[model samples]
Target: MAAIRLLSFLDAGPLAYFTPLGAMALFGAAHFSGYVKPYAFPLLALFISDLVLSFTVFAEFRTGLLYSGWYWTYLAFALMTVAGKLMLKEVTISRLIAATITATLIHWLVSDIGACAVENKLTFAFYLNRLVTAIPYELNFLGGTAFFSAIMFGIFELAQRKYASLKPAR
Candidate 1:
């Protein structure tokens, strides 16, 4: 997931929003046991990836170890993880799709609100405009989340079928 995010440097366009982060958070929440494995690891990966992007792709925008408003992204990610935990206890195709949609919407709302607050244009009009204009990017985000979630979950399901040890202990 970190590697996939780093690849965003190759394209800063709408496609830049296409990333496995939402799926990573969801996957971690669904599969990994314990508080640290599900939340800390994915958050750490996100921070490390952001650190690299700050120095390389977004150097001009960098203010410190991370860019400004970094907390907003992290908050959204954490919320997505929580969403996965609440929504995906069984992990079916429909649940995956629903969780991905929820994650995408969560990211869009939280990050865009943060952007508005950071820019000090927190008016209703500005917020609405930001939300309206960001639809395409969010759609790409949804697509990426769905795509990666399917791949990750499908592979793990297959592996569990082939290797009994791979299945979680009841």
Candidate 2:
């Protein structure tokens, strides 16, 4: 979990000298532009991680090269990003908190629904069972998203403060 948090921070931060520009290029601009691009990076990361694990690391647990559940999961991710972009114009603390919670909830519900669908024709009790099973995973997602959102918003605000001239005047 610590490693995942670290990777998310490194992946989300926009430091000029320390961070990779490619990742920033993908997620950072959306912070200012209200663009729906940050969704791509997380989705890409999730897909690639799953793909690699399925092929190499966790081959036994892996179901296939592309899990059918991934489509819904990615769609949820995209919607979460779009929610962040449309709902958050600036990186305020409240907005970040709300966005993180929203993202976590969206991922939880959508992914679990996908899980139920994949399993096929589950009853209400089964869906309730799936919802209960998702608690830990949702908590982890909420925690990770909050951690990373804080890092990203903090760094962006720091940069905006330090290099005020670079920011657009409004």
Candidate 3:
């Protein structure tokens, strides 16, 4: 838990999206292979990290981490879990990339919508403005999603091969 929190803190730092948010959402969906696990687990991660980040690092910026747009982003992440439930199996690199890309795009779009609505600019110009403004964040999320997805799936694949307990029943 501490390791995940540290990683999430690093990820939330201004410079890097090196967090495992997207990856774990996908992983929870794929590994747990159930509805509740997919949403509850990764969302729990977000909850804990957001709480800690709120009181610690991000406190100056905002009193609480649960900002107005947070729900949209959380929903988007939950959708990524659903995408994992539907899209990932056999745990190949290609599948990981595809799923990561799809999920990241979804997260970007949905969360941006919330931002747009909050800013009262759901128009084309607003969308374009955010396109420019949020490009960096989108890129960071994409890289983070892909990087962690690779690690999570790679580790699981290795474990499954080496340990009978990890392998799916035949």
Candidate 4:
């Protein structure tokens, strides 16, 4: 996932918002049994990726350890992990679709709200414009989340079926 994120920096155009971080968080949440592993590993990956992007692709935007409003992105991932934990106990096509939508919406709301907060724009017009302008990016994000979720979940499920040892002990 981190590698994918790094590669994504190569093209910051229409697909700038498309990322696997959401799917990674969901994958970790669904697969890992313990609290720490799920959140810790995924968030760590995100942090590391952010660190790299801060120096390379986002050097101009870097403030401290990362860019401004970084916490909101992490918060969105954390919440998406929670959503996965709640909604993906038994991963299925429908559940995955729902989780993807939930994660996308969560990211959009949290990040956009955070952006507005950081800018100190506490007006309805500002908020509305921010959201309106973000639709395209959010759509790309939605596609990335759904595409990666299907690939990751499908591969893991197939592997577990083929290799009994890959299945978690019940």
TM-scores, one per candidate: 0.94, 0.75, 0.85, 0.93
lDDT of 3 by residue, 1-170 (tens): 32564564665665355568889888887788556877887788888777766666666645345555678778888898888888886566788788898888888788888889777888988887886788787788788777877787888888888999998876
Model 1 earns a TM-score of 0.94
Tens-digit lDDT track for model 4 on 1-117? 787777767787877767788888889889998878888867988899899999989898889989988998889889999999999998889998999999999988888888898
Best by TM-score: 1
Candidate 2 residue-wise lDDT, 1-170, digit = tens? 22342354344343211222222222343554544456556665666655754555446545668655678777777777777666576656776677677767777788788888888956788888998987865666666566566666677778878998856578
Worst 10 residues of 3 by lDDT: 1-10
- TM-score for candidate 4, residues paired by index: 0.93
Clashes of 2: 0
Which stretches of model 4 miss by more than 4 angstroms? Answer: none
Candidate 1 Cα errors over 4 Å, as ranges: none
Top-lDDT structure, candidate number: 1
Q: Arrange candidates by lDDT, highest first: which order?
A: 1, 4, 3, 2
Clashing pairs in 4: none
Model 1 RMSD, rounded to 1 decimal: 1.3
Clash count for candidate 1 is 0
Q: Report the error of model 4 at residue 24, Å.
A: 0.6
